[model samples]
Structure formats: C-alpha cells, structure tokens
Target: MTTAKETVAPSMLAADPLTDSVDWLLSKLGKHIVMAAPLGLGKPNRLLNAVYRRVAADPSLKLQLCTALSLDPPTGSSSIEKRFLGPFAERHFGKDYPRLDYTVAQRRGELPPNIVVEEFYVQSGAYLGARQAQRSYNSLNYTHVARAVASFRVRVLVQKVAREPGGTRLSLSCNPDLTFDLLTETEALGLPRPLLLAEVDPLLPYIGGTASVDPAFFDRVIDLPGPTPKLFALPREPVTDADFAIGLYASVLVKDGGTLQIGIGSLSDALCHALILRHTRNADYLQMLEALSPGLATCDLVQAQGGTGPFIQGLYGASEMVNDGFRSLHEAGILRRRVVDDIAVMQRLNSGNA
Candidate 1:
C-alpha cells in the first residue's frame, strides 16, 4: 500500500492575496502539492512566480499548479488567445517549471485553443430527491464533471459553506440562500459538497447572495477586515443608437415605480438608460394614484404611462454574473422580489415581460 504523505498542504492561495500567507505555505508545505488557484481577483501571476521560483531552485520539489483564469465569453479575448497565450505564459520559463491549465465556466460557442475547455451538462443520478435522475439531462458535460469529482477525490477549500436544500456546498459567503442554491444543484447530482469551509482566517461576504447562514457550519472562523479575491464589478459597455431603439420598446412596457429584474446584455442597459431619460424629461415617471381615494384600488399608473407596473414590489435577479448595471438598479430600489409566478405577474413587473 502506498503511504499517504504526512501533512499534505492543499493551498487555496487563489482565493486571497497575502504574501505572508504564501510564504508561510512555502515554509510549511513546500511548493509541490499545490493544485489550482482562482485568478479572478488577486495578484495570481505574482503567486505563480513565487511558486515557480521555489520549484525551479529545488529539483526535488517540482509542483503541479492548476489555475482557473477568468475569461469573459461575450466580448473579452477569444478562446485562442486565452488558451494558447495563457498556458504559454506559465510554461515560457522552460522545463524548470511547467504550466498546469484548465478551463472554467465560459460562454457557449467559444472553442479555446490548446487547453481543454469543459462543457456544461447535467449528470445522471444527480437530481437529489427528484423522481428521475436521468430525466431530460440538460447538458451531458456537467454530468462528466460529477463523474470526475467522484473519481478524482477533488477537494474545495474556502472560507465558508452552506447547507442547501439539496445538500451542503462550500459557500464563499454568509448567505444561506446562495448556499441553498449551490447545494441543491450538487445534491441533485449525488455529489457530496467538497467544500472545506471555515478553515481559514478572514471570511469574506460576497455582495450578490443573501449573506446569511449558520455559524456552526464553519470549522474555523476568524475576523479579518478585507475583501477576499476582490472581483471587478462586471463592466457596463457603451450602448449604440440601435441599442437605444430596442431599449425604448422595452422601456415602454416598464411600470413607473414597479420592481424590475433585467437579464444581462446590452438590451438591459439600454432599457435602464431609456427609463432614466423618461423620468428626467417627462417628470411623469413617479407613481400616481387614481383620484377615487387614497390607496383605494391601487393600480400601477406607471405601467400605463410607459413605465413599470406598481404591484412590482420587488425584483430578484436570476442572472449568472451580476454586473454594474444590475447593481445600479438594485441600489436604486427598482429591483425586488415578486411571489407570483404567472405571465401576468411578470408582465406587470416589467413593462415588457416577454
């Protein structure tokens, strides 16, 4: 039987950027056992260099490093640039230290060069307690992910975890709601949550999620006042006249003060800008009640006035990446949750529910 090495270090340095932390990792665990790091928000290249320097100097400690570099599918660099240039950068220093690569969630239709691009799909026997685990599998690729995780014994280390309805998944926030969502998906796939939550100092509260979960779920909780892997808020691109033309149509359906949930895209931004323009120019943008009586038979007049509906009390975003424009709407109190799940409810919420 092969003896497991004593004191294995699964360094998740990608989540946070701290030199002392990296140095401590080097001193204790050396540089060989580190796997992948999340490069969305930190000085990842710096960490990689430090790891390389250590590994290059000591022939006995050649390590394999995995990285999940951020790539925007819509308008960012193409797949060829990402894959070809991405791995080339790390391996360019020569055989002293080789490059380790992998792909993360990317937009559809992009074919990355050199590196293996993972596909998105639902797995079998992964529907948690649903009737049929193999029913209408959305994508066969995600199922492969489940198979790999089960086979490879992958471990996910993070600052927090949550007990979702489907199962527990590592959570990067205090938000139980978000935890529930991630866990539900994993549980459906029959995969145990591979999260090592509350194992590190300095917990970070992600801005997007509900931000509430039980403290007992954490193994170790330390207070550190800094954002972990600070991500740039998704950028808002400039809109064109064609964009405005589309926005006007979408805007015509919006209720004046009703809650709205806009999906991600140029159309959403245009709609927002158009709404602001109407409110600024027409002054008839705010909520107005019927002259019958105060709060008697309240109907969203804003909707009638080419604004959003009144009963649109709240908005809940179901988008994958929360961008700046979405954040702006939330901050402006235009986004809220709606309990109704009907077409009327949706149409009433946004001027153009379709």
Candidate 2:
C-alpha cells in the first residue's frame, strides 16, 4: 500500500511552458478525455483550450469531453429576472472565465461535428434552458461519473490543482470530490491507468483532507505561473424573517456536541447563523423563538440536546463542501470537535466514557 507521504511526493517532470504541456497531452490523446468540471475552479483551462485548438485544426478527429457543470457566462435573456441577473453575472464572472472554448462553440452552434461536449450536471441558468443544451444534455447522478467515463471509453484524465510551493505534487484544493474516485475505479477495472495530466497553478489554496496527489500519478505536469482562474463564488442568498424562524426551529433539534453536514446556500447560512446566535446571544434568540413558536424552547428534546448556552464541547463539521458558513462557525469557536474513525472509540465516546 502506498503511504500518504509517498502518495503526495513530487515525482514527475514539469513542463515550464504551456505549449510543451499541450504537445505532451496531445500526443497521448484517445478518442475520449474526461476532465474535472462544475468544480471547474480547479480545471486546467489552458490545456483544455489547447485541445480545443487541436480539434479545430482537425475535423475528422472525434473527441468527447465528458464532465458536469460546465459554467458559462450569462448571455442576454428575455425574462425580467434573467435580464437583471444576466448583466450582474456577466459583470462579475464574465471576464474571469472569458469565452470558455467549449461553451462558446456550444453557444455559437459551431462545435466541430466530430468534437462532442457532454455535461451531466447543467449549470442552472437561462442559457441551459435553451434548445441546444436541453437537446445535448445527458442526465446522471454525480456518483455515476466513473461509469460515464468508462462508458465513453475515456482514456485520458486531466484536472487542475495547486502545486506544493516549489514542488510537483498537486493539491486538488477545491475538487478532490471525484478525481480520486475516478482514478480508483479505473484502476480496479484492470484498465490501463488513464493518462493523468495535472495543471499546477499558484493561486489555489492548499486545503487539507484527501486532496493531495503524487506527481508520479500524473503522466504529465504543466506549471502555469500567475493567478489561477477565479472560482464562481455562489453569492450568499439573503435571509428572510420566515427563513430565520425555520432555522430557529431546526437549530433546537441539533445536539450540542454532534456533527454537522450543512450544504451551501442561503438556507444553510441562516441555520448556521441561528445556531451561533443561540450560543452567543441566547436571551435574544430565545425571545425570537418564543415569538415564532411559544413553548418550543421548553420542549424536552430541546432541553436535552439544545440550549442557549455556549458550546462547551463544540460541533464537528463533516460536510462535502466546507463553505463560508462553516468558516464563520469555526471563527466563533463552535466547530472545534474532531471525530475519529474507530468503532470502539466511537462507542466509548457515545457512552460518555472516552
């Protein structure tokens, strides 16, 4: 078994210029290439663009790009809401992602006849509601990414990450979600390990967890200096009074020393905020709770598991995406509990004898 340290060591040769990397990848191309998507913040845009150029140069070379959540800049829309959001989205996210090659080709109805772009999770927008996207959409669950790649006969896998400063090992900072699983699946099936490519950027934060990959795993490495592409920050949604009331109700059921698995968005934010308020501003929080639903604060379940008192043991976060809300909760000293993975230890903890 490969140890963590061995698996995260820098062992591959680096390509200094973008062209060298592109040429290396192009030479090993198969009919299909699977790329990191939706989670496109960590995607290798330069290398993919180079692939697009190659496809443009050769009309008969059929290449299927399989991935999900291909984010595109907002184009004009007819609906009033879209009209307002379109310009706002463009003003913020347009220049950063700049005419993503496949999206542009898809929008202009000029994708090469042989080059097919398939997205499992469509970006939610007026653009996706159009005829072309709807016609080309391949609906699938996120868990089925490996199966999709296998079905498409994908022989090349490419993703982006942060290189350990002055090292070659890459950190899948924002998207260790699927790449590891994809690699595992391909390996288990007795398939030749797909040609792995890593585009190393300097700007991505080297987050912890199962996010590191050895340079040996990658067939080629491209070092692109300067700022990496900015991620599409899902703007925090505004919280309403009703939303806060619901959050207050939900917060009372959560055990003080339990784990949290909150997702991204306004509802999650409201819930976390309510929990923090319940801990720090208990009197005010209880008053609001009383006004929203009298006697809820006095329930036996609430009395046992919830309270206005500050967290003594804190809560552990075990979420897929540790969003800004979790960061805030950490800052407020509420998310400090750490869980271990041993069954015997867990039993001891549950029995309050650890």
- The alpha-carbon deviation from the true structure for residue 138 of candidate 1, after best TM-score superposition, in angstroms, is 11
Model 2 Cα displacement at 225 (Å)? 5.3
- Model 2: runs farther than 4 Å from truth? 1-19, 30-38, 77-91, 94-96, 107-110, 126-128, 147-151, 166-168, 225-229, 300-310, 352-354
lDDT of 1 at 85: 58
User: All candidates' TM-scores?
Assistant: 0.42, 0.81
Q: CA lDDT, every prediction?
A: 0.40, 0.69
Candidate 1 — worst ten consecutive residues by lDDT sum? 1-10
**Cα misplacement distance, residue 96 of candidate 1 (Å):** 22
What TM-score would you give candidate 2 relative to the actual structure?
Answer: 0.81
Model 1 per-residue lDDT at 196: 30
- Model 2, 1-354: lDDT tens per residue? 112122221234344355555455555664444443435565566677877777677875666777766656566546887878876886676445545687777766777777777777766663443555566778887678776666555677767777777665668876686777776777777676666667676767876556876777666666655455565555567988778777888888777788888877778888999989977888988888888889988878889876656688889998757689899999889998767889999788767799
Q: How much does each candidate deviate from the true structure in C-alpha RMSD?
A: 13.2, 5.2
Question: Per-residue CA lDDT of candidate 1, range 10-83, in tens?
Answer: 35333343343344444544544433333333213334444445555566664443222332222225887767
